[model samples]
Target: MIRKFLLAALLASATTAQAHEVWIERDGTGPARIYLGEPGEPVPEGGDPEFAKLKAPKLINHNGAALVRKAGYLEVAVPAGDVRAWDDAVFEPWGEAGKKESVVYYARAGRSETRAAMPFEIAPVTAHGDRFVVLRDGKPVAGARVTVITPDKWSKGFIADASGVLRVPVREKGRYLLSATQKDEGAIAHPSGTLAALHRIATTSFVVE
Candidate 1:
């Protein structure tokens, strides 16, 4: 009971940090599009302002794929593979007036890959399964909080166990988004300026059929 309470509290604290995330979506034989917004929310004409902030991320599992600007997302040329995206260009101070922090974003398209390819990543436990592991610097991040958005926009939060693994309950046959946030202490010196705390938000998307 105490453990569950602690997990719930952690998830609650990440509400604002995980409010919006970068996710990738790709249907069969379709272009892999990277979107910046809340899952299930309507994107604006050119995506949210934050979307504009997205420079090219260090894409894994594919090479030489250009990010084409679109009305609401960035389109990739890759048709398959893990096709993950990790961008630290958004490493700027964010938040209201005095309490801002340096934030970075990582995203992944849930393919049949079980290896961690980003500094912070959410990878499948098996070639085919709802079980996922949250990793930071190639290591499991125990107690990490994960929030999942389903096809119907229904959502739920879960805490990674000691092994940094969590099984998502898949009840529908459609796309799903999973997000997690990790906070680190200390200030950071960026070319832009000095940043307060550091926060990393990672999101993964997959289609379940």
Candidate 2:
């Protein structure tokens, strides 16, 4: 209960150290659209971290393409074969608006089935559907917020249990974006003041038909 309260406090904090979910969504073999901010809201046009800032989301495919994230959106070139992709990185800390903090963003999107074991990553534990497990440091992350975004731009939020497990019913028939976040209450010094750091992980998007 106490930990749940702390997670809520972290999400509801009124600082630039805001909790956010980022994902790359592709529609029918078309260009990918990267989204930032809370789910269900329209993807913003600016003020988003770029590939250089997010430490570059890695894409494993032919030629080992040079990918980039920009304008709160990233255009990805999908190769002509099954692929596994992921961008799991921690960025340099920044401060502003009387808040100091750091961000860790990670996401996976592709056709490959082998889900890489990642620190602070989300994995599908069920044979199918929207069930998943939230992992941090290779362990379960309980009481995390797992939000889902449908291709129609509608979204609903869900929570994980003590085992960091979540099962969200599939309600749409296009594409799906699953995301969750965790906070590290232990803070560090900053020019503005002491700040609490937050870590967020993006799911290797699942689909429902």
Candidate 3:
């Protein structure tokens, strides 16, 4: 019974770490505006809707120009060319046991999409159809679970192959989010004890008509 309880506790911890996802929510599109958030039921029930509570998130153009905007949520417009946005690292430390850190990103490819300029990042190594790759410190991360979400919260999960590439079929194509959660066995040692740290990253993109 004690062993079973420990197993359940471990599973619960892992699930909590996997819950962080970064995705884009499109509002109106006269010039094409997008909001960022973790797609969930709604706010107040653990939903951080519409880029709520984030600092001045910015949209960067391919030419290295950046536009900073402010709001209760993050809203930005992609330029006529390639653009991308990334979040500051959000770290969650639970007890002396360990910590879980995640960074979320969104990119609108102008020509071709490759690895993002993030330390622990995930991006599309292929077209936005289905295949993607997860990278930690800019290297392929195998064994990460990439959760694919379609409209209405329809979700399917895929595992990264040895090359850290994921291939999952896109059914219809509206808005999609691909999230990856990875946990390594290394932890930072504090004065308290050895603290375990898990790394997770996610990306959101879409297929347009």
Tens-digit lDDT track for model 2 on 1-209? 99787656654543433445556666555555555555456654574443234445555453366555567665667753333344433334553434546655666553334243456667776545466777787778788888877778777888899998888666768766777766666665544356675445565565554
What is the C-alpha local distance difference test score of each model? Answer: 0.79, 0.59, 0.52
Residue 109, candidate 3: how far off, in angstroms? 8.0
For lDDT, the strongest prediction is: 1
The best-first sequence of candidates by TM-score reads: 1, 2, 3
Which tens-of-lDDT digit does each residue in 18-128 have in candidate 3? 554444444334133333445544433323543443443345443344334444233455444334555543323443234433333433322136746655556777644
TM-scores vs. true structure, each candidate = 0.82, 0.64, 0.62
Best by TM-score: 1
Off by over 4 Å in 1: 1-18, 61-63, 95-100
Better of 1 and 2 by lDDT: 1
Sort the predicted structures by lDDT, highest score first: 1, 2, 3
Off by over 4 Å in 3: 1-18, 25-37, 40-52, 58-72, 89-111, 184-198
Better structure of 2 and 3 per lDDT: 2
